[model samples]
Target: MGKLRWNILGIRGNPLATRPGMVKIQEKNVMLRKCWKTLLIGILFTLTLLIAGCWDRKEIENRGYVLGVGIDHVVSSGPKGLYDLDKTPQAAGQRKYKLTIEMPKFNKQEASKEVNKGQNHLIWSGEGESMFAITRMISTKTYFSPFFEDIQILVFSEAVAREGVGDILDFFLRDAEMRRLTRVFVTPGRAEDILKAKLQVEEVNSTFIGKLTANTDKAPYFAGKAELGQIAQALRSNHSFIVPIIVTEDKEVRLLKGAIFNKDHKMVGEMNELEILGGKILRQTLKQGIVVAPNPADPQHTVAFEIYEKKMNIDTSVQDDQILFTVKVILIGNLGENMVHEQDAVDPVFTKAVEKEIAAEVTRSIKAAFSKQQQLKADVTELGDLVHRQHPDYWKNVQDRWDEEVFPMAQLNVDVKIQIRRPVITH
Candidate 1:
């Protein structure tokens, strides 16, 4: 108050009161702005560097796409037959199974083209004591990596399937790239034959085989086609698994029969066309068929009914010491053809009679399958599972002799009900 202080600029209080502190603050602000610009530039440079690298890129031309897998058993000379003393017989004989992978020839130009041309399918075989060894050998021989993600079919030799499928499927189940949706089949002879068979129609044998099994729905007797996942589940469950069997006849692949497996993965028996339909009914997987009914009046002519849908249910019960199994099959179909005397008028009376005959055919087919089971000593219908489920206490008593004792004596009762939804139209 004695002497009033004035700023050098003369507008307000002294400007130099905290001059050093103000200079320090301005310098800190400028340094912070420069540091932020430098940090932003470093981040942009890192992103640009990553965009130029190809560390995870895989070109299609460098991959060998697998379409099908075939496995067979190699006959070895040994007292125990491919068995070693150190390992269990099943594990010891595992080396007998030969693995084959089918792949199309690699062409960079063809691979890049929208349509494939002039590329033939090639099959490579590898021998090992197990699937893992075979796969390792394949990788060693080929420069490109083998990919199993595209595999659509798996074929097994009769010998391998008859011996056991547990070991054959072990590698497929464990592999990360193998697909679960692949279809599985059993060849009548060596599995290598199926993979090596040259088709006149298709470019590749695997693609031809895949189409043959996929279109089997058009056939009268075939049931639900077997898939890898389905077979795996059946093998693990109490019920046995069934796979379509193919044989080469006159240089053409044909559906010869169906191979049936027991719980132990051994091929117990085979079923023909009629037997397959009957077995499908027992398995509750039958879908469609054509039922031919003989004319009562003409006796020489027959009427055909085209089945559109079918549902089957199996029930089993145990009373005292005897076991009873009942099958209920319902069919919905349309009257397709009347080859009896060329009648122009439709008759409802004859239609009812045809329904009765259709039911009889189903009953007869099922009985034939039962007779085959008795001859083979195989419970292909999973009667064992029903017995175990309905009467666990009794099943425990006969678990050892269930196959030999209760299965042979098992009684079957079949009931078939058919309904005609449409009548044949006369032009």
Candidate 2:
């Protein structure tokens, strides 16, 4: 085969025979080779730049991830409910809460070698006039940046909650990294105890507390789950607020009662298990439970029904210058255990009796909660808001005297309708 000769220009002359033409062709070939090499180098350089580089990257071990925070009122010997400017220069004459932050410590090498050692967490604490200030102090003390994104629980001391929770929560809500879904808990005596409580089952104390609050939905006495967003909204709402109360018994954190708050953020009263269950039912947040219905024919034998579904509708009416609130709750479930003397499982007579029993139970529970509300004079359920929403004109007339005259005089009527889907087991 014959080699093809290069033609730089159509000059119609033999480049090999002419010196100037040959020199021009050689220069053009050298330029073309140099251009190809330059293009290849540019492509390689661009690929090298595209590779990942360490730009603001942080290793997991370097992060101080906070799991829980506890706030407690500290007594400074400076002044009465005030801080001495000479002793503490940060803020003059301002009382503050001692804040504790719990975080997990992960030694990279040890963690990589052993998984159990990495699970061990540590807690750091600081004191300042305010929660925000204390958190700032913590950041100054720790070399690593404290991250609040991983916080799962927030424990507030009884004294702090009794004084006021609005201010303490203001910091959490305003912080960009703080999660609104984190669980907020009210400790019985001191929040530090709850934070320091050893994890009996779960690996992390925060995880255990998180699971405890999450499992409240399955309990009979507990109502809807309390999250950071819900509490913040309740604080800003027109009505009162209620929080899930936690108590330490036998060194275990237990959900015992609910803290009832008046118009102010301070807790005015509390509800026990029975009262909390009744209040939850009135609020229509009860998820599941077993209701016992005594047999009319046989006093000893009682029928049990497993509540699968429940819906509550509250209606208010102004009659004769008096506000009357009627609550209608419909429940649909299956009969779990029946000890009554009846062979027919789907008998119409048995169904009617069950409905009556359910109605009586609902009425009793509602009355019980109302009785407590009257006793404490605390509108925990925000029934006043309901009246205001339904009858705005009437509320305006009695807005000032609603808490004193109207609320005390308000009457509640509860009606329940229950339908049984099936028996515990098919006959």
User: In candidate 1, what are the lDDT values of residues 1-427, reduced to their tens digit?
Assistant: 3234444323235565358765676578779999999999999999999888887778876787889888987656457655556532343434566788888765635533522332367678877677876776788778876788988789998888888888779888889998888888898788888877755543566767777776566565764477888777776664566788887765577777888787677888888777776776776656665867675446588777788988777888878788888889889988777776555325777777778877887788788777677667677766677678878998888776766677878888999998877867746
Could you give candidate 2's per-residue lDDT for residues 1-427 as a string of tens digits? 1122433342335455367766777689789999999999999998887786767878887778889888888755644545534534576436577888877657645433433432356778877766777777788777777889988988887788888788778889999999899988787787877777654443456767777866776676664457898878877864466777877765467887777766567777777766776687766678888777675446588777778888878898888998787888888888777786564657777777876776676677778887777676667777877777888888889876665567878888888788888854776
Question: Any idea what lDDT model 1 has?
Answer: 0.74
Off by over 4 Å in 1: 1-56, 75-95, 108-119, 217-220, 250-252, 293-302, 341-345, 383-404
After aligning candidate 1 to the native by TM-score, how far in Å is the CA of 393 from where it should be? 5.2
Q: Best lDDT goes to which candidate?
A: 1
Q: Residue 169 deviation, candidate 1, in Å?
A: 2.1
Per-candidate TM equals: 0.76, 0.75
**Displacement of the residue 338 alpha carbon in candidate 2, Å:** 5.1
lDDT of candidates 1 onward, in order:
0.74, 0.74
